[model samples]
Target: MGVVEADEADRPVSSIVLIEPANRADLPAIVSILARETLLGVRDSADPGAFPDYERAFEEIVADPRTTLYVARLEGQVVGTFQLIFFRALLRHGALLAHAEAVQVDPEVRGHGVGRAMMDFAIAEARRRGAGSLQLASNKQRLDAHRFYERAGFEKRLDGFKIDLSGH
Candidate 1:
């Protein structure tokens, strides 16, 4: 999950590259990555071709001060994405907290450090934004993902359970 320096600063960075506050133009690629991963995990996800109208969501998030999206690019192709949502909580000295959600790396880019780079960027972004704490949720069955998070200094501190509301 560590960043590997390139021979030239201007040269294309390898494995993992992070770009923050992705625009609506990036949603199609991000949706593709999510759909692919969801299919691999056997989750009832929307079809890649039917990812819906994300123009409004993207515009809203990009315009909002409390939200950000980090896109992982490999060899100039967007291969993964994650979102950070910031909120204020009274318990933490009235400081901002950031939560990372919907993290996904393309199957082709998995194990190549893309996910790690994206997370590293998110953590730095949270710090830059004056967030007092950074958190993320991972499913219990994703052992590999959990291990990766652990290696990156995350701890399994909370258990979250949920039931679907879509009534599928």
Candidate 2:
């Protein structure tokens, strides 16, 4: 995708955000954003020792045909990141569903429309790929994030549930 200039009346006139497929070099910035800016920060690490694991995970994500890791860059600096995964769901009559995860925007750029641009890109990509709908689950504790999503046109339609399997 090409760069999207922030034209919202409330956004800075000079902001130009680019959303693109993440490469190996972007992993560090991506990891930093996730570890420092999100609700999952406590569970994520930006330590050197943790990087190899992130690298491996990045490789795996890119290798999977149905998944993609994307980064939002402002003037060549990574400022946001998200992962989009597509899957066919039996419950929706085998509809193609796009699930977005790990969406994080650097605090410095929060009000600059970077997140909006990223969500716009995600929605367009999902539609282009024939997905019936795009869905995402934000942790219940993230009230601000929920508001952001709602502002992006996502509705709180269904209650989401999860189970930790790391102990198994």
Candidate 3:
């Protein structure tokens, strides 16, 4: 789904456009932002051309109805990106849950509320989709990100465990 909305802050806020299902053209910028994260950066190439497999994966994700790859733009330039996945589970009364992943904002615009707008969009979209909850998982090393999420109204509700099946 495609959408555009003005900043709704009662106080002044910078302009940011959140696009659901981010297009292929935004890949390079998205990669750049992902490369800025201390933990994720070590595993990222930052240059999309270096990874053909990512292109294939991106295509698959784009075709999947349950996922949306969001790209945040400012002044027509892509600055941030994330993936939101919708799932239904027996828990929460089988309500659909919105899970966000790989959220990243350009280092150049880190303190400009760009991440806030992206997250606001994710939360709003989850509500729009009748989701029971909106959630995201941050790396244990991302203390700053945890603080940011808390400031954005997220809580430390559960402990998450993951198996490294990728074996990287």
Candidate 4:
């Protein structure tokens, strides 16, 4: 609800960390971390660059006021990143909607609450931007992530089906 602050004593071993928008300088690290996370536990995955081109994508997001990209920092090291995109519909009057995606966390800090802090920051930021609702679709295989979202007070809105529009 309120601001989440990382305690100084918890540094290294434990830290609360702060979440802020990703800058141009942080793109390389962000991309590298995402590549690693995406490849983990997969036997025959596609190329590492299969994910969104964070450098270019982030630039566009930064240029647009309707979108936000955030990175979680602890002890001056980025541990996680996520993005929030605000959408508006003319029929909905002044209501705003936010969609979150590309959530990735460093494996070394999995249980240290870095992910939770990032999600909380995203939620707060969305609310601050006057978003009437927030939505996120997690992959079905990410059961742990599903639990994490539920623990954060998000209820399952759908079974999260997908259609492969990427025709080869």
Q: Can you write out model 1's per-residue Cα lDDT over 57-85, one digit (the tens) per residue?
A: 67777888777777876666887788899
Error of 4 at 133 (Å): 1.0
Q: What lDDT does the true structure give each of the candidates? A: 0.74, 0.90, 0.80, 0.76
On residues 69-154, what C-alpha lDDT tens digit does candidate 2 reach at each position?
Answer: 99999989999999999999997789999999989998888878888889989999999999999999989888988898999899
Candidate 1 wrong stretches, greater than 4 Å: 1-16, 39-49
Which structure is stronger by lDDT: 2 or 4?
A: 2
Model 4 misplacement above 4 A: 1-3, 6-14, 39-53, 90-94
lDDT (Cα, tens digit) per residue for candidate 4, span 1-168: 223564343234355577888888887777766767654363222255743555566778899988778888877888888888998866568678898988888888876778878778888878888888888998877889989899877899887677968573
TM-score of each: 0.82, 0.94, 0.87, 0.80
Model 2 clash number:
0
Q: Score residue 160 of candidate 2 by CA lDDT.
A: 86
From the highest TM-score down, the ranking of the candidates is 2, 3, 1, 4
Using TM-score as the measure, which candidate wins?
A: 2
